[model samples]
Target: MSVTFNDFNLQTDLLEGIKSMGYKQATPIQAQAIPHILESKDLIACAQTGTGKTAAFLVPTLSRIAEGRFDFTSTLILVPTRELAKQIDDQVEGLSYFTGATSIAIYGGNNAQNWDQQKHALTSGADIIVATPGRLIAHMQMGYVKLDQLKYLILDEADKMLDMGFMDDLMKIINQLPKERQTLLFSATMPPKIREFARKILQQPEEISLSISKPAANIDQQIYLVYDQQKLKLLQHILKDVEVQTMILFTSRKSAVNEIVRALQKMGFEADGISSDRTQDERESILQRFRNKQLQVLVATDVMSRGIDVDNISHVLNFDVPQDAEDYVHRIGRTARAGTKGMAITFVNERDQERLVKIEKLIERELPKITLPEAIGESPVYDPAGNRAKFSRDKGGSGGGRGGNRSGGPRREGGSGSGDRNRSSKSRGERPAHVTAGAPATEQAPRVAGAPSTATGEAQKKKKRRKKPFKPKNAEGAGNSTPPAPAPAAE
Candidate 1:
C-alpha cells in the first residue's frame, strides 16, 4: 500500500523537497487526492484533521502550476481562519521550495502597507495565493488581486467558514474566479449547508471521503465528569502524570482561554493562550514556541484546533466543552496525528450534559467516562445571575421560601468569641450552607467584602502547591543516606 511521490510523477524539484523533509510514502488522503488533482479534475475531499490533507492538495497543485501552463492568479486557496491561511501558505512554500513557483498569503489583522508590498509582488501575479475569505474579497474589490487567470480554487475547512458566517464572502470570491477553473472543497465534516454550497460551486467534482464521523482510530477518547470547581484540580493532577508531555487545551470562549492559561501558569505549568485577541505576530510566536517544545501546553479556542499541524502533541484537553459537535472532533483531532497514538480528555459538567449528548450523536459513539477523584463532586451548576433557585427544587412544602431563605436568621458562629461573632466568623467559613432535603450538610463561606471566598481561596492555594517542582522520593532519600565505600578497581 506504500506509494512514493515519484510514482505520482511529481516535478523533480518538489520531490527533492519532499525527500528533504524525510517523507517518502503518501498518506491515505495524499495517496488518493494527489492523483485526481494531478489529472486537473475538480474534487470534494472529506478528510479529517491530521490526515495529511494539506499535502494532498499542495503537492498536486504545485505540480500543476509548475507545468507553466496557467496564467493570471493561477491558483487560489481560501481558508476560514487566519491561522489556517498561514498554515497553508507555509505548506505550499515548503513543498514548492525547489520549484520557482511563487506563493503569497494574505489575511486580516495585518497592516495595509505590508499587504500593499505583497500585492505589488503579486501584480506579475502569484502562482498561488492562500487567503482568508474576508481579506481575499477586500483585495479583489480593491483591484490588488486578480483571478481572471485563476485556474484552480481551493476551499479548506469549508464547514468552519460556514460556521463563521463566511458563506456570503466565500460565494463572492468564488463568483469572481474564472468559470472554467477547477475547484476543490475539503472539510472535516459535511453538513447539508456545506453540501449545498459545494453543489452551487463545484462542477462534476470527484469525491474523496475519509472517516468523517469518528475520531482518528489512533486516538483514545475519555471523559471525566467533575464539578466545575474541581475540574482545574483534576487537570493539574493529569498534567503531573509523567505520560503527558505536550498538550493543546481547548476552551469554549476567549475569556475562558485567558483564565485557564493564567490558572495553569499559577499552578506552575508552562502554558499560554492564543485567541483572536492576540496580534498576528504574538500568535505566530506562541505557535513557534509550541512547535519547538519550549511550551508544555497551549490553551486556545476552537480557532487553533483546525489547521494547526503540530506533530508531538501528546494530549488534547477540553477545559471547556465545545458548543458545536464538529468542533469537538477538531479539538480532539489535534492529537493522534499522522498515524500516531494520542489521548483526548474532556471535562463534562452538569451544564454540558445536553451538549455532550449532541456531540455523542454526531460522532455516533459514546465517549467512555473516566473515573474522577473522590474529592470532586457532581458537576457544578452554572448560573449567570448567581441564583440557585432555577436548579434547586424543594421536596417538602416547608415554604422556607423560594430559592432557600437567605435570611435564615443569621447563622450562629461556632467559635466562642465576643464582639459580634457573626462578623468575626464571617472572616472564617461563614457562608450560606446549601441544605438539600436529605443530603449531608456542607458549609460554604459567604462572599467577603473584598476577599475571595473560602472555596476560591482554597482552590487557588491548591493550584499554587501543584505547580511547585516535584522532587522524587528516591532522590530525597539518597541525599539523606550515607555515602558508600569506593569499590576496588578491576584488573
Candidate 2:
C-alpha cells in the first residue's frame, strides 16, 4: 500500500513545507520509519541512496521540533562528509521554511569566515545542526557549544561514517549527549558491525531494510572489456555514439581525475573534475554548476559518489573499476534516480577483471559485455585467474602493472595497471624496454625478466654525494638555514 504525507498527522506548518517541496507521498523507507520516529522509538533503518531516507528522519524530527518549540538546540545530525552536511542543511532550509526552525551546517574548510560562522552558530544554538563528525568534535572541544538539552541525535550515512574511521569521534560526541534523547541511525547497509554498533546506542530500535546492494531496475548497465591503452578511445566512442546531456564520470584515482577531464575537454566535451583536493567552496561550485546544467560532464573520485544528489544525470561512466564491490553500486546509483531511466557504462581493464567479477556477484547478475570496436583492437581475455597470476609474477619484474607503485587513498589499493590508471605507462607513452613491440593485443602481460635496480644505483650516488665532508665557505654563513618551499596540497 502506498502511504502519502497527508496520513502522517504532521503539524500543519510542516505539512505546508512538504507540499512546497512537491513531496506528496512517502517513500517506502519514509513510510516505515517515520511512524516509529514520531513515537520517539530509536531507529536503525537501512535504505540505499536515492530512496528518500533523509526525509524519513527529517520529517518526523521537524514535526517534533514544531510541536515542542525548545529554546536550546534540539537536534544534531552527524554525517560523514562536508558535502553531506551541506546537503542536509539545504534540505532543512526548504522543509522548515513554513515552520521557522533554524539550522546550520558545520564542516572543516580553509576559509576563516566559514569557521567564524560555525562558531557563532554553535554559541547561538540553532534549533538543528548538520555537522560532520570531525568538525563537530573540533567545536565541541571548545566550551561554547552546548548540547545538554538536545532532544534528537541523528546519524545519517552511519556506515560511511564508521568506514571513514570516525567511530572514536562518534563515541566522543555521543558521550556528551543527553541520555534520554531520541537517536536515529540511518545507513545504506546493515552489516553485522552496524548491528553491533546500533546495539550499543539504539534502544529496541525498529528496523527497516529496503533495496540492499541493488541499483534501480531502470538502469541500462553495460560493461566493456578494454585494455589500458584503449580506454580513452572507448570513452570517446561512447560520447560520440550516445546523446549525453548530463553525465557524471567516476574514477577510482584522484590523481587521474585531471587527466581524464583534460582528455574529455580536448575531445570537445564540456567537462570538469572535482575531488577532496579541491577546497570546500570549489567543490560546491562545481556541484552547483553541474546541477544547473552548466557542465555536461563532471568527473570525480568516489568521494562524490555518496554525497552527490543530482536527479537528472543521464549517464554514469566508471573510468576505472572501484576497489570495493559496494562502491560500484554507489557510483552507478548516481543515475537512474528520481524515476528517470538512465545508463551506466564501465570500462574494465585486464588488471580489474577480478573486481568486475566481484561486482557481478554482488549485483547477482552477469553484466552484458559490449564488443570492442575493430579499430580499437581486441581487449584482454576475461581470464581473472591467469591474468592475476601474471600480474603477481610481474611484481618481481620491470614493466607496467609492476608492484610498489601504490601510494594514495584506499581506492588506489589493489589496483594494478588499470586502464589509464597506470600513470607510469600513460606518462612514459611507451612500454618498458623488455616488452616487445608486437606484444599480444589481448594482453599487456607484465612479463619482463627483472626489476629495475634503482635502489642500488641511488645508494652509490648518495655514497658519492656523502654531504661533501661538511665543508662550508664561511662559518657564519653555515649557521644560517634556508626555509623549505611550501609543499603542494595533498588529495
Candidate 3:
C-alpha cells in the first residue's frame, strides 16, 4: 500500500500547501521521516541530497507549528553553507505559504540593513529560522537573538557542516537551544564521526537510511589521462566541440580557478571564477550571474561543491583530480540533478593517477577513458596500480627521438648527416661509433633491444617542462584558503 501526504495526518492547511507545490506521493524518506517527526520523535536520517529529505522534515514541522502549539521560534535548522541556508529558507516559504508561517534565512552576505532585518526577525521570532552555524553564532554572540521557545532543532546536511569545520560552532548553537526540543539530524552519509556526533545529540532517535552515497544514475562520467601541460589545450579543444550551454569547472586550487577563467576568456568563452577569498557579496553576485546565464562557465574550488543547486548545469569538468574520493561524488553531484542527464569529465595527470584509482574504487566502476584530440599530442596511459608499462610512441607522430631533431621529427636545422646515421643506429640497438663507456655525460647512448632509451632512462636530458604555478595577485586571493574566521559584524 503506497502512502501519500494525506496518510500522514497533516493539518489541512499544510496539506493544501503540499498540493500547491504539486507533491502528491511522499518519497520513501518523507513517508518514513514525516510520521516519526510528527509524533515528536527525534530522528537520525541517512539520505542523499536529492532524496527529498528537506520536505520530509520541513512539512511535518510546519504542520506542528500550524496546530497553534506554543511557539516563538518553533524550529531551527542549521546548514553548512550560506547558499544552503537560503535554499532551505526558500523552500520553507513555498511550503508555508498557505499556512501563514513566517521564516528567515540567516547568513553572512549582507550589509548593515540586512543585519538589522535579521536582528528584528530574531527578536520578534519567526516560525522557523534556517541558518549557517557560523553566521548564527555571530548573531547569538550579540545576546539579542532568542531561541528559548525553540521546540524543533534540525541539522540538515550534518556531515557537510562537520566537513566545513563547524563542530565548535554547531556545539555552541546546540548549547544555546533548549534541551527539551525535538532534534532531527539528516546526513547524506554515515561516517564514524557523524555517528559519534549523532550519538551525542540525538536521544533514542529513530534511524532511517535510504540508498547509499553515489552519484545519480543519470550522470555520464568520462575520464581523460593527459600530461599536465596538455590539460589546458585539451580543455580548449573539448570546449570548442562539446555542447556547453551552462557548465561548472572544478579545480583543486583557487589559483587554478582564476587561471582557467582567464584562459577561457581569452579563448572567447564566457567564464568567471569563485573562491573563498571573494567577499560574501561578490560570491553571491557571481552565482546570480551564473544562474541568469550571464556567465556560461563557472570555475570554482571545493567551496562551491556542496551548496550550489543550479538545475541547468549541462556539464561538470574537473580540471584536476580531487584528493578525496568522496569529493569527486559531490563535485559531479552539482550536475545531473532532478533526474536530468548531465556529463562529468575528469582530467587525470600522471601524478594524479593514484587519486583516479581511488575514485574508481569508491564509485565501484572504472570510468570510460576518453581519447585526447590529435592536436594535444601523446597522453599518459591509465595505470591504476602504478605498475603499467609505458608504451613507445610511434615515430610517425610529432616530436623528436633525441639530439638529431629538436622537434622530434626527421629533420633538424643545422645537424650533420652523422646525427641521422646515429638515430638509425640508436633505433637498431647498436652503440653509436663515437660513444664509449667513459664518454662525456652529454654523449648519447643507444637503446639495447627492448631496454629503456635515454628518453625513458635516468640519463634522459630533455624533460617536458612544467608550467609555472599560478599565484593570486594579492594576499586576499591566495589558493582556496577558508574565508577569514567568522566574526561578529557591526550593525
Candidate 4:
C-alpha cells in the first residue's frame, strides 16, 4: 500500500518541508513506524540500510515537538559513529528547518569548547540531541546536558554500538534518562544479544523487519576470485573501465585502508583513506574531498562506512572482506542509493572464502562471479616478508605502510628492453637501424621475438612529438563536440 506524509497526523510545517523536499510517498519503514511514532509509542524497527529509516522516526518526532505537544529533552538519538551522529542531526535539521524545533549533534573528536557553545545554545533546550554513547555519557557525568525529561529515546545502529564495546557507556546513559520514556530501537540486523538488549529497553514494542536475504534489490553484486598476490592487480583492471566513477573501497582494518590507498595512488588514481586512527580534521578533509568529487576513491574501514552518505557513489569494492556479515551490507550500502543502480565488487582470496560464505549466507544469495583478464594474475610485490604481508611494494617501506613513499619507486630494470632509462631514452628521440623499411627487415640485429626495437622506440618518440599540448576548451565548444546534449539541470 502506498502512503504519503498526509496519511500521518504531522504538523503543517513538517508536511510542507516534506513536500518541498519532493517526498510524496512514505518508504516501507516510514509507512509502518511513523503513525506509531506520532502516537508516542515505543517501537523497534529492523530495516536494512538505504531504507529511509532515519526519516522514519525523525519526521514524526519532529512533528510531535513542533506541534507544542511534547516538552523537555523529548528525543535522544544514539548512534555508533560521529559520522552517523552528524548525519542524523543534518536529517532532523533539514526536516525541521521551517519549524522552530532545534536539534544538536554531540560526538567525540571535536573541541569541548564547541560543544559547550552548542550546549549553551540549547539552554532553552533542543527538541533532539543526536550523539554517540561516549560523548553523551560524558555530558551526563559533567552535568553539561540533562535527560531527566527525555521522552523519546532512539538507539540507531544499536548492534554496531554493542560491537564497538559501547554497551557499558550506553547503559550508563540509559540509566540516567527517565525510565518512562518511549524507546525506538532500529538496526539493520539483530543478533541474539541485540535482541535481548532490545527486550530489556523496549516495552512490547512494535517490530518492523524487512527481508535481509539479498543486497538492496537495486544493487548489482559480483565477486571476483583472486589470489592474495593478485588482488591489487584485479582491482586495477576492474577500475580501468570508465564506468566506475565515485567508489568506496572497504578494508577490514585501518592498516588495510592505508595499503589500498597506496595501491590506487601507484596506479595513478586519485584516492584517499579514512580510518579510526585518522585525526578528526584529517577524516573530515578526506570526506569533504570525496563528497565534492575531488577524490574518485575512498578507502575506508568498517567504522568509517557508517557515516558516509554521499549519493553519487557508483561502486563499492570489498578490497578486504569484512569480518562481520552485517558490515558487508553496510559497506555496499554506500552505493546504489536513492533508487539508482550501482555495482558492488568483492575481491575474495583463499583466506576470505569462509567469511565470503558467511556473508552470502547472511544475505541469502550467492554473489555472481566476475571473470578477469589474464594479466591480472601478475603477483603484487608487497614489502616485508611475513605470513601476513603487512604492506604492499607500491606503498614502499615499513610500519604497516602508513603514508610511506607514495611514488611507487622505480620498476626493476631487466628483461632485455624493459628499463625505465631505456623507456625514457626511447621517449625522447633515438632510433636503431632495425626498421628502415626498404632494407631487409631481417637484417636488424635479431631483436628478442616480441621485444620493441630501437626503431619502435623512435616511432614512440615521433608520436609524442606529434601530440598536441593540452589546452582547456571553451565549455560551449566542448558541449558541441559531444553527440548528445548535456543533461538538464537538477531540481
The prediction achieving the highest lDDT against the true structure is 2
The residue-by-residue lDDT of candidate 4 on 130-234, one tens digit each, is: 877765654454455767888889999887777655676677788878989889999888789888999888887888888664566889888776665566677
lDDT of 3 by residue, 172-260 (tens): 78988898989999998788999999988888999999855678789999898887667778898888878888899986554456768
Per-candidate clashes come to: 3, 1, 3, 0
TM-scores, all candidates, are: 0.73, 0.80, 0.73, 0.72
- Model 3 regions lying over 4 Å from their true place: 69-71, 213-218, 227-229, 333-341, 377-491
* Superposed model 4: Cα runs more than 4 Å off: 69-71, 110-112, 118-124, 216-220, 227-229, 336-341, 368-491
lDDT of each: 0.69, 0.76, 0.72, 0.69
Better of 3 and 4 by TM-score: 3
In model 4, how large is the Cα lDDT of residue 239?
75
471-491: candidate 1 lDDT, tens digit per residue? 567785745655444432211
Screening candidate 1 with a backbone cut-off below 3 angstroms (N, C-alpha, C), the clashing residue pairs are: 267-467, 431-445, 431-446
| lDDT by residue (tens digit), candidate 2, 1-491 | 78999999798999999999999889889999999999999999888877799999999999999998889999999987777888999999999999999999987654556767888888987999998776676567557889999889999988777765567778889999999989999998777888999999888888888865588899999999987668777888878888888999987666678878888899888899887667778889999999999999999776556678887889999877875677789778878776889999999877788888989999999999899999888977888888788777775575554232222223341134443322211111111112223321111112123312222344455555654336466866675656444332211
* Better candidate by lDDT, 2 or 3: 2
Best by TM-score: 2
